[model samples]
Target chain A: MILRLGADFLVAVLFSLWAGRPGWPGFVIGLAIGFVIVSTSDLAFGRPNHGRRLLWMIHFAGYFLAILIRANLQIAREILTPGFNQTPRIVRYPVQDLDDLQVTVLANCITLTPGTLVVDASEDGRWLYVHCMYAEDRAKAVNGLQKLDDRLRREVFSW
Target chain B: MDTVRDVITVILLGSGLSFMLIGAWGVVRLPDAYHRLHASSKCSTLGLFGMLAGAVVYIGTVDALIKAALTLLFTVVATPVGSHILAKAAHSRGLRQWDHTLSDELADDQRDGPPQV
Candidate 1:
């Protein structure tokens, strides 16, 4: 709670600076407003995991950005090249261990990556139906997605 | 300093534009909805990220940076959700895959009983 308040204070100062009103008065005013807004919203939303969410956001930004760049390049190359070296496939990825939110996050992460799309999830939420643009080696593609899942499990959703 | 900023902006904006064009081409040229979604989602997201970076650098204002950050955040969150729903709808609507598609593991799973998770 104290840490969350500290972060709110810092963000308030940043906002003050961004608004071209950087000063003690501005900082104090921003701090009060930021605190009230952030606290009220956080309470209203019933989010007890603010710290983890922030960590996930930071990690996700860096990790997703790196992969996004690579995906762009890879897809561009495939698009520009002549012969059809790509094989499209839809694979059902198992995800029963994860809760609903985790499963949803995992599905979205797969969709966000290049060359893959989440077609559907099983009724029980145990299987993620994913379509891949390049599936030359089926095991390799599944393994790649599994790797992403492990990362999300270990890094972002770690308790 | 201004010249350096201009150089950075050009580099970022050029790549962003290239990705956007690639995405558009993929949408038109790709065989099916799923394939096109791959190109559209990935390329457009990265392209937007690049363009936002360029804008933040060129403008060089704290206000601009904050706005850019918010836009980037929204893009990151929204794109995947949008694509997921579209892909789900396409599949449910019985959209045909490209003729060359080698496997339908999901269908096979549905037939054979889903793998135990």
Candidate 2:
């Protein structure tokens, strides 16, 4: 908890610095904003799971950024190249283990990533129908989704 | 040092514009709605992010930096949700996928009957 609060404080300090307040005023404002951030996150995301949650969140953010960049490059290549290499398909991706929030994150991440979009979900919420822009091999596409699921399950939703 | 910052900003802005151009081209050239969504949403998200980043670097002002950062953050978070809702609505409305589409398990499952769960 202390570490998480400290991290939030650091982020708030950076924000204050960016906002042109430096030195003592910035520190004071950072302290206040940091407390608000910590409390608000607790209220929104439920209680933190030890100090590890922050580390996992940082890891997730890095991974998400990497994937976002890769997704864009892949799309750009497709757009610039000659003939279509796409073999699009809508595949059912099971998400029975994930709760509502986890599922929501997964869906959004899938949509944001390379060559995949979340088109729909099953009535029971057990499955997400993803449209893959390149599904030349079905298992390969499903495995990509599974890797993302594992990452989320291992990192963000471990609690 | 000023020259270095200007160069970096120019590169960022140029790449951003090119990405936006590619996104527009994709939208026009792609065969169907889902493919176009794939193009427009992802590319434009990154393109706007790059442009905002360039703005932050070029402006070199605290207020502009904060505003650009917030804009980028909100764009990153919101774009995917918007595309997801659009894709779902299109699917539910029976908007046809490209004829060459390899498979559609959603339609197959629906055709099979009510969802098992």
Chain B TM-score per candidate, please: 0.94, 0.92
Per residue, candidate 2 scores C-alpha lDDT tens digits across A1-159 of 556756776777686778778655676688677767776787788885444676787899899878988998999898888878799999998888778888888998898889999888888889899999999899999999999888988887776
TM-scores for candidates 1 onward, in order: 0.81, 0.83
List clashing residue pairs in candidate 1: none
Tens-digit lDDT string for candidate 1 (A1-159): 546766786778777878778655666778777777776778898866555666676787699778778888888988888766679999878887899878877887888776788888888887888898788888988998998888888777764
The residue ranges of model 2 lying beyond 4 angstroms of the native Cα positions read: A1-52, B114-117
User: Can you tell me which runs of candidate 1 are displaced by over 4 Å?
Assistant: A1-60, B111-113
Instruction: Encode model 2's per-residue lDDT on B30-65: one tens digit a residue.
Output: 889999999988998889988998998888765676
Q: Which tens-of-lDDT digit does each residue in B31-85 have in candidate 1?
A: 7888789888888888998899999889876568767988987987788888888
Q: All candidates' lDDT scores?
A: 0.82, 0.85
**TM-score of model 2, chain A?**
0.74
Of the candidates shown, which would achieve the greatest TM-score relative to the real structure?
A: 2
For candidate 2, give the docking quality class from DockQ: medium
Q: What TM-score does candidate 1 get on C-alpha atoms? A: 0.81
Q: Fraction of native Cα contacts kept in each candidate?
A: 0.74, 0.74
